[model samples]
Target: MEFSNTREFARSMDKEDPLATYKDEFIFPEVNNKKVIYFTGNSLGLQPKSAKKYVDEVMDDWANLAVEGHFYAEKPWWDYHERFSEKLAKVVGAKPPEITVMNTLTVNLHLLMVSFYRPDAKRYKIICEEKAFPSDQYMIASQVKFHGFNPEDAVVEVKKRAGENHFRTEDILKKIEEIGDECALVLFGGVNYYSGQVLDMETITRAGHEIGAKVGWDLAHAVGNIELKLHEWNVDFAAWCSYKYMNSGPGNASGCFINEKYHELKEIPRFEGWWGHSKERRFLMEPEFQPEPDAHAWQISNAPILALAPYLASLDMFEKVGMPALIEKRNKIVAYLEFVLHQIDEEVESDFEIITPSNQNERGTQLSVFLHGEGKELFNYLMKNGVIIDWREPNVIRLAPAPFYCSYEDMYEFGQILKRGILKI
Candidate 1:
């Protein structure tokens, strides 16, 4: 489809957008008595209007029912997390039993590593992308140290070639083959946070398995923004936070995915809690740990209902529109944004370059613009003008036109504001 830099063309596209009505579902921040143009869903999603309603329901239940709310509330607190299974399964493309909502992203990553990252003497190395999210880097390094291995010796990183901004899939596959015998695990972020590159998860999983290693993903950016098939890909395990593309509140509860094949294996080691015990035997308080026969077995505590409530509100929207439909709108809006940026560069004769891959398949909603000469000045200028985008270290501005709330006109207006900022700089 062709794109134009004109405001009227963008407005026309917004009018034709099938998912345009979803804009009203979210509450945006205002600046100078006007709604800001928000494009930071990759960092923090705008809150959905229904989030307040769902959270209020939980508060009411707690107020009215007290301790009996576990069994007597409209939606029982004891099983609050269970309500997300089907909805989250649909979002991540897994069997309902294979998915469970639990602790934060890094905590779940550590828990999953306890079970999957069994590094014996012969196979002690783990392969991951260089410059992974700090939490993941810390988790992998700490886990390697816990197993009595030095991080520098035990962790293998797939890095970009000199002068390149992203890792090539062939290079990653070759690295998996090169470290074949010693690799115990291959863990990577499904969508890289800095460059916004989406990895080839299925191929990575296959290659890791062929090398006799377990494969997992930190799907913090991929979970709600892109289509995933963890079960079909045969991924060993994965985890993600709800606040980014999922549009849940800050520090919300997270979701985890474990292959069903691992469910019935009683020998798998995990840090246990009562919530993970079989539901029938849970209240009986037996001494032995009787794990649930699914992903819930990995849970370390009971659900945080207030945190889970806002997530439910967002998941309901996902269920209503479905991922395919959401992604369809996402692709077009991102392309339009890309087109608008290119036009701004040409008009202003600036050297801003997009570091994120141009291929739609290799990215989600984010476009990481490398501000070659102009630094945070341009970003600050835009922010002052109520154009909300994110700034990373060095000199990159990240903008994500989330499909649910951001409209095509937002992209057009952003481009105009960016051009004005560039001219001033």
Candidate 2:
């Protein structure tokens, strides 16, 4: 289907967009004296207008109530974490107890690994994507080394067949079948950070269970961008950071999920902390660790209200718009971007292809563009011209038009800037 390459066409789309009013809710960045056409929600989302008020509430509580603010503040600092779980659960399609907001991404990954990566002599290997986010790779390598296992032997890196940019779901299932017996954990990103491919989580989880392996997802790029049924998917555990499509601020809070089935299991080893203790007996200061029955049992420290507040605000917005509606809008906007980009690429016979699958169900809001020439320079040029997408090294550029705020006009503006940027090269 051909799309009109005219400003009037873009205006018409924007006029009919049900969520267009939400554009006013964000604080967009400006580059070189112009409002940036931000297509990088996959990297860092635009801040919500309410983010300031949320932070201010916490600051006000701290300033006025001192340490006693934990139980007495307007939002009640001690129960601050609880305030977010219900809304967050709705966004991710899990029950409240199955989720908890806490720590940075890699930190939570390590904590979850400690509990889930229990390997015996017969089953001691971990399977992950080959070009996973660098931090995930490092965390896995270090965790394996800490267990006295050489990463080269203990970690299995899965990749696409030769000449392919992304891995096929069939290949992943086959690999799981081949190595299931020896695999202790299958830790995969729900949507790959570089490839932007949304794996079949339900199918992947079922395959892992068939092999007696624990299935986990790192949802850093997938959380708000895609619809997830972590509980129904029977995911053993999952972790996500909220700074991306969730539209929470930079370095904002992260969340984790553990299926209710595992919540009752006493033998599942975990790294215990005071926060993970049962709420009824937590203040008793007992020497024994009595863990909570759900994902809260994974918490290691007191809640960070300053960082978490923005997510609460964003999650409320998500609840208002609803995931199904958000995803439907995202599909149309992304399709437009892809269609426009393909038009220009065809004009020049450019050596570029979108590595993210064309199937709507196989991706979220992001499109990973692979460029044939030196990709970094083109990315830099786009940046200088105020097209705010992000670059993943070695030749890929990722663009995500977050549904809540980005508009059809934003996409058109981006196309104009990108086209000019390419022609200059």
For residues 1-425, write the lDDT of model 2, one tens digit per residue.
Answer: 45776788888999989999999999888898888888888888999999889989999989999998988999987768887778888888899999998898899999988888988888989999998889999999999889888899999988889998778889889989989699999999999888788989999899999999999999999898899999888898899999998988898888888888888876678888888888788889999988888788887788988888898888889988999899889999999988878877876667788999998988889999988874788898998888887887778898889999889988888778777777888
Which regions in candidate 1 have their CA more than 4 angstroms from the true location?
none
Query: What's the TM-score of every candidate structure?
Result: 0.99, 0.96
lDDT of 1 by residue, 55-118 (tens): 9999999999998989999999998899899999999999999999998999999999999999
lDDT score at residue 317, model 2, on the 0-100 scale: 94
Error of 1 at 110 (Å): 0.3
Against the true structure, candidate 1 reaches a TM-score of 0.99
For model 2, the stretches where C-alpha displacement exceeds 4 angstroms are none
Ten contiguous residues minimizing lDDT sum, candidate 1: 297-306
**C-alpha lDDT of residue 229 in model 1:** 97
> How does each model score on lDDT?
0.94, 0.87
Compare the candidates by TM-score and give the number of the best one: 1
